[model samples]
Target: MRAGLATLVLLALAGYVFLHYQTGGARAPECVVTGTGTGEPYRLQPQQAANAATIQAVASSRGLPERAVTIALATAMQESSLRNIDYGDRDSLGLFQQRPSMGWGSEEEIMDPVYAAGQFYDHLVQIPGYTTMPLTEAAQMVQRSAFPDEYAKHEPQAAMLTAALTGRAAASLYCTSAMDPAPGDPGEIRGRLAHEFGDAVRTDHSGRDITVEVPEPELSPQGWEVAHWAVAHAAEFGVERIVHRDRVWEARRSVKGWQAAREQDTADGLLITVAP
Candidate 1:
């Protein structure tokens, strides 16, 4: 009787494995940000990835260092979990939970991720040596949250995101969706990219193919920075494939992450092929 029960259990477990592979393999469509070494990778939904990318983009636009990006990300993670939330403590709103009553901005401006991140950095840079300050202290100086210690918990995850979003980690960010979404609008993608990155990014689109090339990113970190941004936004933008130098990521095959490109194109900074 014991031997028969053991066989029955094995059969049940096998059935569960089959069901899971057949139905649960899609994984709910999310993006992952990884750092160097053996650190655990952090996962984020597409919307969260978009907000995090915006925070980093704003810092890059101001030519701020990576430390500024790290601080802003930690504060946002604590305040809104990197989401552009509409409700918050009292009148606080948006990614950084900036309160309009506190003169952060009008509600509409505060809701805009780019504007919110810019405001955070504007105050952050004014603090004496914020870059070198402890993560919680730097954030508290700008935020003044009731729980000044809350931001510290998010520092490690924020730094991991900073590395991927800032191009310090290459091919370290990717998204997986169930299937490709409908054909995406190149115009909308271009406009949103401009809204976040400003003049720092330039794209020339022919048909559904958009070439995102930065100026000599070899000397700058903007190459993979923009590349990873494209990957993070892939699900939202209906991006079908992305090519950066020797690496390639396809939406359908993104489960494999960034694979080696069959033909390397190191000259062009990045080639993004949206849904046709």
Candidate 2:
């Protein structure tokens, strides 16, 4: 069997074991999702967290419901452990393990998380009553995986992840970043935001920071959406601090999560301070 297929088998089994028994070796810079009124925080690796956030952003951009995000996350967790892998059961690739043979997309396109997620949603919406259907049922209708039932086990974890990444869980998602920082490219940051959020979000460059704006009414949830996405992509974008409402996440600090900004909110959008 191909290495990708072998890896998929091992990861799928490991995910099942980890979720079921809560046993796994520790990983550094873990992504913790909490405050969803659940039993405990759901943990993931940083890359998994990034992928999950991207999935949530893409779904939100398309005006899809939270149910769609839940279904997508659960499917991704089951298929690839939420990592954008280049290998899978057979010609499968990316977060959702979509296959070229199955007419999902070109290999290059499928590997792109934004494109892969869009495709997933496209197929999902066609399934009538999918929002009301059980997650496993909805996912199976789209994925048609050999092990159709496995998606069920991941829903609880996925739901928690969605809550935080979607900005519905307030400041529950957190991560640590390198103390040292470098100047970031505004163009690249804008490109990444547009790629993930489509046109729903706008970015402005000022010195070393980028101000991200969503439609007005800039409620806590929407503000947190931009803030958490900044945190999730902190390493990639050289983010130093993110301020939304009265809370802030500073990379050089020990909080490793959101904390009081110690100042009042004078703006309507998220202020992402990057290294200069």
Clashes of 2: 0
Best by lDDT: 1
What TM-score against the true fold does each predicted structure earn? 0.90, 0.86
For residues 1-276, what per-residue lDDT tens digits would candidate 1 score against the true structure?
999999999999999888866653645777887667787889989899988998998888788999999999999999999899999999999999999999999999999999999999989999998988899999999999999999999999999999999988888998876566668888888888888888888888999988887677566667889888888888788888888877898877877788888864443578888897
Q: Report lDDT (CA) for all predictions.
A: 0.87, 0.82
Q: What's the CA error at residue 47 for candidate 1, in Å?
A: 1.3
Please list the residue runs of candidate 1 whose C-alpha ends up more than 4 Å from where it truly belongs after superposition.
1-25, 217-219, 264-267
Error of 2 at 80 (Å): 0.6
lDDT of 1 at 85: 96
- Write the residue-wise lDDT of candidate 2 on 27-64 in tens digits: 24565677544478777777888888899999989988
The clash numbers for all candidates, in the given order, read 0, 0
